[model samples]
Target: MDEVEVVVAHSERATLRVGDVFLKVDGDRARAGVEARAMALAPVPTPEVLWHRPPVLAIAALPGRALAQLGRPSTASPAAWAAAGAAIRTLHDAPLPPWPGRSADDLAAALDVECAWLVADGVLPRDLVARNRRIAEAALRPWTPVFVHGDLQPSHVFVEGERVTGVIDWSEAARGDALFDLALLTLGHREHLGDVLAGYGTGPDLDRDVIRGWWVLRSLLTVRWLAEHGFDPAAPGCEIDVLRARL
Candidate 1:
C-alpha cells in the first residue's frame, strides 16, 4: 500500500503527497479555479495538472527539490536562486491573469487589522508594530500591476542543480505588484538577493526601499495567520526576524 503523506494541513486547505502525485484540497473552489487559470496563463514552468474536481486538485510532482525552506539555511547555490529569479521574470512578463490581486487599500486595511490583532493579543510590542507599519507605508504607493505569484516563497520554487525546474502553488497568482513577489522570495534569505536581482535585471520599479517596505508589511500581515496555523513566524530568521530587521 502506498503511504499517504500529508504535505500540509491548515484550517483553510490541506495538501497530501502520495508517491509522485500530489493532491490539494481547498475549502474555496474559486481559489482552485484561479490557480488553474493562472497555471494555464503562466509562461514559466508549473506543475502538470492531472485532474481537478470541485475542492480537490491533483497534480504531478515536479522533478526537483524546493529552492529553500523557511527558517532553514538554503542549500541551493546562487545560480539556482538566480534561475528562480529568471523564472519569476518570465512569469511577471507574461500576460496578466484575469483576476485582480490585493490593492494598496486592501493591503492597508489588512495591515491595520493584523496590527490591531497582534497588539491586542500581546504577540508583539505596540512600538515594534507601529515602527514596522510606518516603514511599510512606502510600498503602498501605486504602480503598473504585473502578473505576480501572490505567494512566491522560496519553498514554492523547485530547482534542479542551477536551473529552476518548476514553481508550485498558484492559488494566490494574480495581477499585482511585482516587487511584492520579489520581496517575498528574498524575505529571510537576504544574502541571496544579489543573485535574485542579478537575474531579475534592474529597473526603476525595483526599488530596494519599497521592497523592504513590502517585507515589513508582508511580515506584519502574516504573523497572526502563521501563529493561528501552527507556524512560528517569530522563529529565528523567519517572518518575525524580517519585522525586527526594520529596527
Candidate 2:
C-alpha cells in the first residue's frame, strides 16, 4: 500500500497525495465545483480528475516539478519560466468564467482592513504598511476582465525542461485583471519577470507599475492569513520580504 503524504493542510482545505493521485479535501463544495469547472475550461494542461466524492476530489499527478516555491531559488531555466508565461497568456485569453472577481472597492476595503490590522497588531511597522499601501493603490484602477487562475502562484505552475506541463489550484479562478496573474506568478522571483514578459509578449505595453503594486498588495493581504494558516510569511524571500522590497 502506498503511504499517504500530506501535501497541504489548513483549516479551509487540505490536499493529500497517495502514489500518483492527489486528493483535495475542501469543505466548501462551491469552491471545489469552481476548481473542477475552471480546470475543464482552462486551455492549458491540467491534472485528470480521477473522481470527485463530496469533500474529496482525486486527481492524477502531472508529469513535472513545480515552477518554484516561495523563498527558494528556482531550478527551472529561463525557457521554462517563459513557457509558464505563455501558458498564463493562453489562459487569460480564454473565454471569461461565469463568475466575477473581486471588485476594486472590495479589494480596497480588504486592503484597508488588513493594513490597519498589520499596524495595530504590531505585525509590521506603520511606515512599511503605509508605503506599501500607497504602492498598492495603483492596482485599484479599472481593467478589462479576462479568465484568471486567481491564485497563479509560482508553485501552482509545473514545468518539465522548458515546457509547461500543467497548472493547479483553481478554486480562486474567475474573471479578473490579467496583470494580477502575472504579478502573482513572478512574486518573490523578480529576476524572471523579464523572461516572463518576453513570452507573454506584452513588451513595453505592460504596466509594470501595476504589477509592482500587486506585489505589495498581495503580500500585505496574505501575510496574516499565511501566519494563521501555519505558514511563515516572514520567512526569507517570503511575503514580508516582498513587502519590504517596496520600501
Candidate 3:
C-alpha cells in the first residue's frame, strides 16, 4: 500500500484502509452556500466532502498540495485579507458543539496527548494548556467562548490564489474566543500586520490588542511545535529570532 501521509492509508478506495479510523467529512453533504464569499480566491477547489468516518477522519481527496509549498507573500493582497477576515467571522458565527463534560484541564490534556510525540521531541508550548486551566484567574472580560478552529496553523489552511480554497485537518476544532483564529493568522504573517487584520468586522466591541498579542504568541508557541516534531529548528532560518520576537 502507498502511504500518502504517515497517518493516511495508501489504498485507492480509502474505505477501511486507515490505521485509526475517524469520521468521514465529505459525507456531511453541507454546501458552502452564500457563505461562499471569500473562498473563491484560492487555487485549490473546496469540493464538498463526500463522507466523514468520526473521532479520527477521512474526507474526499484534497487538491493535493502541501501547506509548506505555498510560500508566503510579504502580505496577502488586500482583497485576500478582507476575504480571510470574513471567512473567519463566518466560521465563528457557525453553531458550536455543546460544552463537553470535561473541564478546561481536560482540553489541555487532550492536546498534550495528541502532541506527545512533539513534546517529547522538545517543543515548548506557551502554557496554553496551563493557561486554559487558569482562565478563571484572568482579569479579562468574560465572554462566552464560541466555536473556534483550534488548530488554525498554516498547515491546515489550503490556498490557490488570494483565497483559501479548503480548510481541513480539523482534529482540534473547539469552543473558544475568536482571537484564537486571529492569533494564528497574525502569527503566520507578522510582517503583514495590516493585511492580517484589515476589513475584520468587530461590530461594536472587540479587543484588537489582545488579538495582536495572540498573533505574536502563536508564532512563539509554534516554535515548540516545530522543535518537538523533529524538524530542524535552525533550518527554517531565524527560528529562534522568530520565537524571541514574539515570546
Number of the top-ranking candidate, with lDDT as the measure? 2
Q: 1-247 in candidate 3: lDDT tens per residue?
A: 5343443222211223333232332222222211122223222344344443332234454543333211344333566655566666777776664432223455345445534533464554545334432332221344457656666655555555566666654434556767667656555455544554564575544566555545434443445545555544444323444444443
lDDT of 1 by residue, 1-247 (tens): 7799999999999999999999999999999888888888899999999999979999999998999998899999999999888888888888888788889999999989999998999988999999999999999999799999999999999999998888899999988999999999999988898899888887888899998998889999999889999988989999989888889
lDDT of 2 at 218: 95
Location of the lowest summed lDDT over 10 successive residues in candidate 1: 90-99
Clashes of 1: 0
- After superposition, the stretches of candidate 2 with alpha carbons farther than 4 Å from their true spots are 203-205
In order, what lDDT does every prediction score? 0.91, 0.93, 0.46
TM-score result, candidate 3: 0.57
- Give the TM-score of each candidate: 0.98, 0.98, 0.57
- Candidate 2 vs candidate 3: which has greater TM-score? 2
lDDT of 3 at 164: 60
Q: Hey, what RMSD does candidate 2 come out at?
A: 1.0
